[model samples]
Target: MNLDREVIKALAPTGVLRASINLGNPILANTSKSTGEPEGVSIDLARAFAQHLGVDVELVVFDAAGRSVQAVASEQADIGFFAIDPVRGAEIAFSAAYVLIEGSYLVREESPLLHNDEVDRDGCLVAVGKGSAYDLFLTRELKHAHIVRAPTSPTVVQTFLEQELDVAAGVKQQLESDCRKHAGLRLLPGRFMVIRQAMGVPKTRGAGAARALHAFVEEMKDSGSVADALQRHSIEGASVAPNEA
Candidate 1:
């Protein structure tokens, strides 16, 4: 469990651990309703990781997943929590997932779409957060459905309603909350995809740094820190990822 000096230096070159926090993913990170400051599972993990490195933590916040990914890939951030995708893998070294979330589809209750499969029809239009994991996954999997991109995951439902799109795609928890807030909206029977949420470091950080961060994440998962964060944050519709070891 020794923290390597070189790894720490690489991870926090500025003597501060800059964590790329995406507030768009409410289950993982979000603005505190009362304080207006950032707080959530990701923030908890960022603080923990920073403490392990004996460095101060700095949050580089973003409103969308794409911008978060960009921050880490471009070395603007030391580490970040991200949904694993091969597209993002090129510029980032990803640890085994510490959590998993469901990517779901939402439609008007009166809409004819009853199942996840039914949303891929030729005339179907799906509203998705631009550069989100759901957007990336669906872009590859769906052939006939046209994707209408929204500015962020939180806006997907609003965009869908305004544009009169056929379906909205996002995290199951987010969709569920939206369904309750707006009413007359329903989630499909099952999930469209399972998002593997993991810790990531810029690949340019070197193999030693990547391995160190990966081991840290694995230890956090095995130690139940990830589960505790989810519970502490009252995050539902998501689960801790299984320990890889």
Candidate 2:
């Protein structure tokens, strides 16, 4: 468990590991209903990273994943947790994913879109959280349906309900929970995309830091820390991501 001093210094230049947590992605992080503080698998992973480096963890919280990415890109945060996306790769160096979450669509009970394939049609308005992995993926892939942007991923379900959108795209678990809380809502049969939840550092952090971060992730996954964190948080609908070669 020996850590390189140079890697730690580069990853946490201020003597503390400032990790950006995205509150928008429920699969990774959310406000604790009891404590109202950020808690979840991502939080655990952040703490683990800092502990391995013998540094204190300072969570830089954001309401959306995009903001977390921006924090890392701007060097405001030493590290961040995010879904691996090509658009974000320009500024952040990503480690192998430690968790895999599903992206799915939700529709009103009476909506005729019974399947994922049926969602891409003219006259259908799809609501998605702006800057979410689903939004980015759908933006590039969807050819017909118009995408309506919501403020954040956690609010996409509400946006769908409020706007009466033909479809809503977001984390599968969040959508499922929303469907349970509200009537006349239903999730599609299968997922549209698989979100690879990974750790990231600013590209300016250097190749050594990136390699160290990547190694840290591999060790966490190999040691079962990622799986344990998911279980500790009582998270469902997500599994530990496979080790990268």
Candidate 3:
């Protein structure tokens, strides 16, 4: 593989790759309790990309997807991992996803909501991480329910419990973990959406960097690096995304 110095410089102007890590999504990243470093599939991918570039990585950590998106949009971080969303696409050039994760809802066991389709009824208060893909999707698709924005996806379950929300929408793995941690919480039978987890660079980084990042993701997917990262990180409920045309 040939390195494009011009594209590398555009994407990593600081001479090092700055990757924004969103700790709010446990499926992708979290603070390791023992090492206190960001550890997950996202971190692994970041390091791999830096290695490919023959550069070092600096992780700009945030507690939510919104903040990570803000970091790249403001050029504070050269690149970020994010869900593919049209709203964010306006400011960021997204690669095809290397992983796919399910988005689902969680409710108190005794709640009347028994299915995914039942969550959109009137009087249902859905709690979601602000600026999350689920929040954006629900904002557009929900007809009757009022959405309560939480600080982040990791906190949405706690907010739902505290606020007595009718539903908590987030990554299925996260909701499942919450259910196990706290009794009387149950995930809906099925998923509401499938999140396409992709890496993005600021649109201002130019087309050259965008093309490079896109190819990088596709190569990783095809070479099994993405799947290897997922297994090495002990990730569950995520699978390598299919190659895109």
Candidate 4:
């Protein structure tokens, strides 16, 4: 299956399908060990899309989601795989969601913030990956918490290791990975947001390309290959219902 040929032909000559990584989540990291090749749910899904489309997966690593979306919106990349937000949806064309995510908070086991409701209540210092979906969501939804945006998930994890902030927040998968790296860190039970992860295509691209890609994803979901890929990479908490998308 010559994926590149098919994807290029489908994309037309003017477009380059681009996929970037939001360095905020280990499971979604371009360098994650689970898949042994920057494998994660998003990476596997994107690769599968590329394979099914007969295109080469052009993987781009971005420090944050803001830059990633910009790549898609500016037509630098034809599509992106990441957590979907209503605000981001307004900027780019999003396909039907392929996965569901729960936002979570990470804290040190002994930190006062672990027990103090007031810390989570209002104006508390919470760390987040800068320019990430969590950053946007935190700023918009967490009115009571003062956000300290870290440049990357590692930075956020490092800060949490140092006990410099009360809590760090991001997707549950990321928080779980962080907890593994830092023994003292633990994830809180509640979710901050429920995210529907999807693919983003530039609005500048022809509608047909978006529709084609959407159909390809739908087919992958229907085939059960998507769930197989996620399980192969050991990605937990991502619900893959056959043909659900």
Predicted candidate 1 versus true structure: per-residue lDDT over 129-206, tens digit per residue: 999999999999999999999999999999999999999999999999999999799999889899999989999999
Sort the candidates on lDDT, descending order: 1, 3, 2, 4
Clashes of 3: 0
lDDT of 3 by residue, 104-125 (tens): 9999879988999988898999
Deviation from native of the Cα of residue 145 in model 2, angstroms: 0.9
For model 2, which pairs clash?
A: none
Question: Lowest-lDDT window of 10 residues in candidate 3?
Answer: 1-10
What is the clash count of model 1? Answer: 0
- Work out candidate 4's RMSD over C-alphas: 3.7
Pairs with backbone N, CA or C atoms under 3 Å apart (clashes), candidate 3? none
TM-score of 1: 0.98
Off by over 4 Å in 3: none
Q: What is the alpha-carbon lDDT for the whole of candidate 2?
A: 0.91
**Inter-residue clash pairs, candidate 4:** 3-54, 3-55, 4-54, 4-55, 123-144
Error of 2 at 61 (Å): 0.7
Measured against the true structure, the TM-scores of the candidates, in listed sequence, are 0.98, 0.97, 0.98, 0.82
Predicted candidate 4 versus true structure: per-residue lDDT over 12-105, tens digit per residue: 3443345765555655555645544555667776776666665577777676777777777776666787677777777677777776777788
Candidate 4 residue-pair clash tally: 5
**Top candidate when judged by lDDT against the true structure:** 1
